[model samples]
Target: MDRVRRAARRAMFAEKPAWQRWSLRVLMTLAWPVGAVTETLYYLSVLPPDEIPRRALAWADRGGDMLALAFSRNVPPREYYTYRLHQPDRRAWITACLYAPESYPLLSWLNRRNGADNNTVQDKSRFADLCRRHELPCIATLAVFRDGSQLWPATPFIPALPLLWVKDLSGSRGAGAARWRLDAGHYHNGDKQMTFSPEALARQWLPRDCLVQPCLDNHPALAALSDGTLVDFRVVTGIHRDGWVEVVATLGHLPCGGPSGRRYIVGAIDRNNHCLISPTLSGFQIIKNHPDTGAEITAQPVPFWPAALELVVNAHKKVPEFSRFVFLGWDVAITPEGPLLIETNSGWGAFNHQRGIGAPLGWTCFPDIVAEYLDFSEHGDAACD
Candidate 1:
C-alpha cells in the first residue's frame, strides 16, 4: 500500500505541466516565512529569562518592517536580524537570502543561463584537474578515495608527506575536512591514530569520496596572525558585459585559537590597498586584535595582494568555460612562492561581504551589474522582488 501511494505521487508529479511545476516550486519557496518565524521563536526560547523579553520585544517591533522588506526587497525574515537589517542605515543593503538558489527561481535560471551548466568549480577533484590543465597555480591532489576504496595513484598507497589535508570532494563550508599529521612514522588525526597499514588506514578513515592534498603553511609575514592553520583570502570577481573581469571585494579568513582549537574570523580588506580592516566575530561583533595571538589585524598590508588579484582575474579570462559564471568567489592561499588557488565558488554567500563592509551591496554598483547581466526587462520587477 505504501509503495503504491509513493508510485502514484511520483506519477502525479511527473504528469504536471512545466508551468504548474514552476508554480509549485514558487509556492514552496514562499513558505520559508513560516519556518523563519518558527526558527526565531526557537532562538528566543533558548535565551536567558531576562534576555528573552527584550529580544522578543525587538522581534515584535520589527515584524512590520520584516514583512515590508520581504515583500518589497525579497529579504527573508530570519536574514533581517542575521544580516542586521533592522538598523535603519542598513535597510538598503541586500540580504544574502535574495540570491539563494532554492528561494529565488530567477537567479537560479540566470545561473544556468550564464554557464552553470558546465560548472566544475564546485567539485574539488575536477577543479584541481582543470587548474592543472591550464597550468594555474593550485594545490595538487595527491590521491582520491571513493567508497572506502582507492580511486587514484594506481598503486594505491598514501603519499609520503609530513602533513596531509583531507576534504569531501564536493563539500563546502569546511564540512568533513580534517588534517592528518605524521608523528613517529604514523599518521595522527585528532584522537585517532593510523594503527594499521597506510592502505588499510585510508580505507578505514574515508567513507565518502574525498581528495587528499598536502597541507600548506601561511606566508611568513602573515604567519603570526594564523594560529597554526593555513589562512586563506576570499576574493570575489565578476565579469562585466564587455568581457572584462574585475575584482569586486576582498576578505581575509584569519585563523584564531578557540576553546576547541582553531577557528576563523572574517575581515574586510581594503580593495585598493589590500589592508585588513573591520574584522568581525561571526559577522556580528567588531574585533581589533587577534584574540589568540594579539597581533593587530590591520597592522600590515596583505602580502602578494597584486599577484593574488591577478591570478583570479587571469584565471577567469584564460578559462573560457568559466566565463559563463558572471560572478565567482575565489579562495586563495599566500605561500612563499606566491598566491595559490584553493577553490572557486559559483554561488558565494553575501553575508561576509555585507558584514565585513558594513554596507549593503545595493548602495554600490553591484545591483546594476546584476540587473544588466540578467536583463531585468524580461522578468520585470519580480526579479528584484
Candidate 2:
C-alpha cells in the first residue's frame, strides 16, 4: 500500500512550484546525510560526559547563582536525569522523568519553561477535564515515539515557504529540527497530497507511543509563518491574582529557513492556548542579508500585545485545565484572526539568544521571578535543584 503511494507522490510533485517542489526534494536529500551522521554520533556518544553539565555550571557561575544549578546541564537521551533534592545533597544522578517523594526536579526545571522567561505552563491534565465539563475543546499532545511505530502518521501539509520544527521530542534546538514534508512518512494512497486534512491527520494517527495532539489551528488563531513557514513565537506571560496577564518577554524566532528569511521573518511563539506574540518588529531589527533568501529583518511593534495578554489572563478561566501555574511560555501565532497555541513545553529557556542581542528593552526580572518560584528563600544555598 505504501509502495503505491510513493509512486504517486513522484507524479504529483512533478508539476508544482519549482521552489516548493525542488526545495522538498533538496531537503529530503540533505536530511539523509544528517540522519546518517546523527545516527553515527548518537550511537557513538558524541557528547562528552560533562559537556552539557559543565556548560550549565559555567552559565551558572557567569550568570550569578540564582539559576545556577536548576537547569541541569545534561539530559540523558533516554534515562539518567541529574537530580537535586529540596535539601541539596549535591546533585544526584537519577532516571529522567523520575520525580517522586522529596524530589524537586519537576519544579526546579519549571522556571526554564520559556527560553526568555522564568515561567512554567500549568499542567492541563486537570484543566483538560475542567474544559470537558464546560464543553470547551482541549487538545492533548502525544509524544512522537522513538520508533515511528505510530498508529497514525500526522497528515502534514507541504508549504510553499518553509516550516520550522524541533525533532527528538525531548527538547527544542536549532540543530534538532528541519523542514519535513509528506515525503518523510509512509501512506495508504499516493500520499503526496499538498495538504493533509483532519481525516488524513487521524488516518495517520499511530497513537501507539507517539504523541497525539490537537491541531494547533483549533486554537483561537493559527497561521503559518508565511503561508508555509513554521517559524513561530516563544512568548512568556505572567499572571497576577489581580487578573491581568502581562507579556514579560517574547523570543521571536525565524528558524533556519533561508538565511534570508531568518533575517527578515520572525514567526509566532506561544506560551499556551492563552497568549502569544507576532513580530511587529518591536524596537530594533536585524539588518543583515539572509544566507538563503536575502531579505532583511524589518522592525515592527509586537502585534496584538494587548489582546494577547487579555487571552492569557482569561486563559485559566477559559481552559480551566491549565490553571496550575501562574506563569508559562507559549509558542504562538498571531493570525489575521487572533492568537493561537502551537504546543506547550515543560522545560523552556529564559534567554532569546545565547550571547548577543545586548540587554532587553523592558523589565529584566524573569530570572528573579523564576528564583521566587523555586522557593529560593527556603533553599537558602541549594544549587539549581
Strongest candidate by lDDT? 1
Give one digit per residue, the lDDT tens place, for model 2 in 214-234. 223312222222323444556
Scored by TM-score, the top model is 1
Any residue pairs clashing in model 1, and if so which?
A: 93-360
Evaluate residue 99 in candidate 1 and report its C-alpha lDDT on the 0 to 100 scale. 28
Residue-level lDDT tens digits of model 1 in 104-207: 23334445657664338878888888888999999978888777777787886655688888888886887678777776677777446335446555765567
Total clashes, candidate 2?
A: 46
> Could you tell me every candidate's TM-score relative to the true structure?
0.82, 0.42
The deviation in Å at residue 286 for candidate 2 is 6.1
What are the RMSD figures for all models against the true structure? 7.2, 18.7
TM-score of 1: 0.82
